[model samples]
Target chain A: MITKNRKITFILSLISAIIGIMFAIQLKSNMNPVPNESRSIAELRSSLQKELEKHKGLLADISKYNLLFYQYESSLNEGDSVSVMKEELARAKRMAGMVGLEGEGTVVRIQDAVIPEPPPLSDLEEHSYIPNAVIDEDLRWLSNILFANGAKAISINGHRIIATTAIRNVGEDIQIDTKTIRPPYEIKALGDPDVLISGLKLEGAEENLKLAGKQLIIEKHDKLLIPAYTDARVIRFMKPVKTKGES
Target chain B: MANRKFYLYLTLVTISTGFLIAASIESTKARNTERQNEKQFQQETQLNERILAEKKENHQLEVQLLELQRKVSQVEEALAQRQSEAAEILSELEAARMMAGVVPVSGPGVIVTMQDSEQAAASADVTKYIVHEQDVRLMVNELRAAGAEAISINGQRLVSNSEIRCVGPTIIVNGVKSAAPFVITAIGDPATMVGGLHLPGGVMNMLQDYVKIDIQEKEHVEIPAYVGDGKMDSSAS
Candidate 1:
């Protein structure tokens, strides 16, 4: 026969097991709500639009400056000169080799920059951003020289560098799915040859390029004419930061 | 003694069964409560997840909207830029046209001849130093600046609405084919316009800057009437 005390212990144990199971079920049900990740994405988009509008206005102003310059130039009679003078256009349109005499200006070449392997601590959590600080400094250095030398505009491949445009750090070996460009970058600049060349040399860009495993070449000739892009982009939208965990 | 033991055993058996039943009842209630609570919690969690997903989707749409807004804004900017530039050029042309006193004969304006340098064409890779689009834009800009009342290429008219574009080495004037010694004509003060283009650092300078480029500015230059339909279609937006 079972003892009274033993029987009571068995009953208590069975009840305890059932209660434990119920507690477990409650815990599982609690895990349903995760809202922060998705909401953050929406918030980001609203902010970026406001930023783009501001920059767009600035670009419009710069274009106005160019238009005013254009209008003022057409009124000159034969043999008249404008504020900006061209040494070559003064004569018949010059062809290659005709203007091939060695000029004293800088030479610009464009190429690709290789991406280094990421560090061990790059657990994908710290947010690996493009090296904006370093890239901006290099670009700023280039800009200072071009500005000092009176460059009206500069083109990389066919892309024009306008007054309001910026040289952004796209990524290492991936700019809009194209290979990342770095050294020996080919840049076509419009301005006074004497002024532009001297300006590039002023900021010690040559030495800086050497240190950074890159190069800068600026070629100045009356024959250096680049076509204007028919479809120039006025602005691009900024992306919002990704939400954590839920994404 | 046997009877007493049997009675004791029966009482014990009854108490144990009653306790077991009570425990079973409590367990059943607790399990039902737990399951209901779990279902409620799951529904709440699912709702939360849905809300989060919706929020994320909304955010993505917003970003796309922002991008579209940026693109449209840029288009508007380009349109304004072209208009102002064209206007300025038109005003200059009008003034030059008044000074030159040329009448509308239902024909294009004075034609200025642009050609590859007669001497430079013999060189290797002649195109390397050919006239560039910018050069044309500069010259055209100067023409407008100089008051070109009406302008055209070959036979196309230069209205407040017209385009002068270059394709590779060839020039595109109002969808018409043209090449070196691009025949650009302007109506207005023919003499004044020619003089204005010849101005140092004007269209002449821009053209000269190109490879093997030559520009001929003339007055009273009779430009042919547009033969081909100058169908002007522009997507300003």
Candidate 2:
């Protein structure tokens, strides 16, 4: 009779434990219905658009400084000090893509490939299907290829390719820095045109582009003009490290 | 005696049952109250919306700040024009040049020469033995932290936006091609820069196992100015 009673106590404890676990789960769900699902798709889209507009205004302001710096430079007279400054500024501007570059190189333009839409109610049709787009990763690889193959300066749709420049996708748009550029990406490189053209063909670049559903158009320009970066960021946070014994 | 023990067990069980029932009843009541508070749930959603809106407003203010700074520069230009302070302008321009890394610089610092390990050639995976762009970037960062006035890898000077990246087997510095045995030159106080590079678990120690690293303290190291197109033609735009 004692053994039967002990078994009944064990069964009761197991049933109570299961009930407690279910209660805890229900409490957790009540606290957090869905994590990070607060913002709707429409809200995110508008926020990104607002950010792009603000960036444009900032760029316009920086261009004014660029104009003043030039005027000051031209005002200086012919002297050792003045000449050195001019030479240095000119060199710095060229490297920083503040100046236009014209050289014999290749221009690669990539566009999204057109694919036929599947029939309605077909098994192949997917509800979450994303259309073919020339992604940032594709452009990054293409630019890296050109840079590696002796391209001195490069510009994509007037945006100068620089070290700090980031290629990122916001929703569906490909953003370089703050500029959102559309399809038919034009990449102009300033280097040996023959070498640049040949380099793209190397390492199955065409095959990779095809797999990504992109069409490539390569043209060798004797004088391809690549524009400078209009917006130069002012370094406010990073000051030069001061050495010892300096005021 | 057996009857007394049974009665004690029965009393304990009855108390536990009463406690469990009371706790369960309280939990259900609390849950019902939470479900009824629709205002709290709406506030949470509204709070998230406010955060995104605030971010947009912040960017708008930044744009206004940039515009004001641009106007201030315009005023400065006008004032300078009236004063005709050529000497002052020339000095400012000179300082700009130095910061721009367009002129050759020389100072006391350390030279780091890194080469692929000889045994790496025989290893199945040779990638581990070769020096990478990150390795160069780490050394450059350490030197800068130690108050390096100037830095260069091979002949390529490290600039503000300069990228040191690897493409295939070669590492590219400032758009210049480079192979193994990268000789990095830094201009700063000889003692401090050396200490920064050779610190415990520093870049030198970390890369020593994969690549042969040699450090030399020099009285003077000259870094040549960038020879590429350094001038911008603003008129073209």
List iRMS for all predictions. Answer: 21.7, 18.7
The worst-scoring run of ten residues by lDDT in candidate 2 chain B lies at B228-237
Worst 10 residues of 1 chain A by lDDT: A91-100
Instruction: Tell me the docking grade of candidate 2.
Output: incorrect
Task: Residues A155-225, candidate 1: write the lDDT tens digits.
Answer: 55545432222243344431211224454345665556777777667657666665554545556676555
Task: Kindly report which residue pairs in candidate 2 clash with one another.
Answer: A90-B230, A90-B231, A91-B230, A94-B229, A94-B230, A94-B231, A99-B232
Per-residue lDDT tens digits for candidate 2, residues B132-197, read 766766676667656666678886776534556776666677555667678888777778878877
Show model 1 residue runs off by greater than 4 Å.
A1-247, B1-110, B119-128, B209-237
TM-score of chain A of 1: 0.38
Best-matching candidate per DockQ: 2
What stretches of model 2 exceed 4 Å from their correct place?
A1-84, A114-132, A237-247, B1-170, B175-237
Error of 1 at A151 (Å): 30
Clash number for candidate 2? 7
